[model samples]
Target: MNRLFDIFRNKYFLSTAAFAVWMLFFDKNDMLSQYEYRTEVHKLQQEKDFYEIETAKVKKDLNELNTNLNTAEKFAREKYFMKKDNEDVFVIIREDAKD
Candidate 1:
């Protein structure tokens, strides 16, 4: 017990402990700020991954539309309301939205 008290009272050990506590709890860039930075980095990484997957899907669809004439025609007709010269197109809209 006396040895432990002596160690605690030593100037070097006391100063080191005080410095560590100050840096961890009271410094400008402390533990809480570090945790927040890590959380933001993880969120941004997830967003990047999601966007990359969406971009790949879009690229695949573009490739299919470019290579397949039937697919291209179907996409154009559905997305842009296009039609052949002799065809009359009628659009039907639903009144209620589905969840």
Candidate 2:
């Protein structure tokens, strides 16, 4: 018991222990801050991955559109309501569908 008390009473040990406790709990960049930073980094990585996947899909679609005249025409007709001369287009809408 006396040996333990003597170790605790040493100035160097006391100061080092106090500093460690303060740094772990009360510093500006503490354990909680580190955890939050890791969480934010993970979220940004997920967003980057999602954007990369979407970019790949768009690139594939663009490549197909540039390579095929039929695909280009189909995309134009479906996406932009484009039609050739003397063509009638009918758009069907469901009343219960959400926009």
Candidate 3:
């Protein structure tokens, strides 16, 4: 008990404790701010990864469309509802689906 009291009474120990408290709570970049920054970085990293995957898939599709005429026609027919000049186009929309 006496030793603990002496330690607390020491100027160096008190100064160090005060500095730690200041840095942890009072500094411009405190613990909470650092944690928020880290979380924001993680969220942005995940978004970047998702976008990269989507970009790769789009590039692959573009390559396929550029290389294959049949695939391009199929894509246009299915995606844009395009039809031949002599054919009639009929669009069937489900009740639950949006325009």
Per-candidate TM equals 0.70, 0.76, 0.78
Clashes of each: 0, 0, 0
Candidate 1 displacement at residue 14 in angstroms: 1.9
For candidate 3, the per-residue lDDT at 34 reads 100
Look at candidate 3 and tell me the lDDT of residue 23: 98
Worst 10 residues of 3 by lDDT: 90-99
Clashing pairs in 2: none
Write model 3 residue lDDT over 1-99, tens digit each, in one string. 999999999999999999999999999999999999999999999999999999999999899999999999998998999999999988887788577
Off by over 4 Å in 2: 80-99
Candidate 1: where are CA atoms >4 Å away?
1-5, 83-99
lDDT of each residue in 4-94, candidate 1, tens digit only: 9999999999999999999999999899989999999999999999999999999998999989999999988988999999999899988
What value of lDDT does candidate 2 attain over all alpha carbons? 0.96
Full-model lDDT for every candidate? 0.96, 0.96, 0.96
Candidate 2 weakest lDDT stretch, 10 residues: 90-99
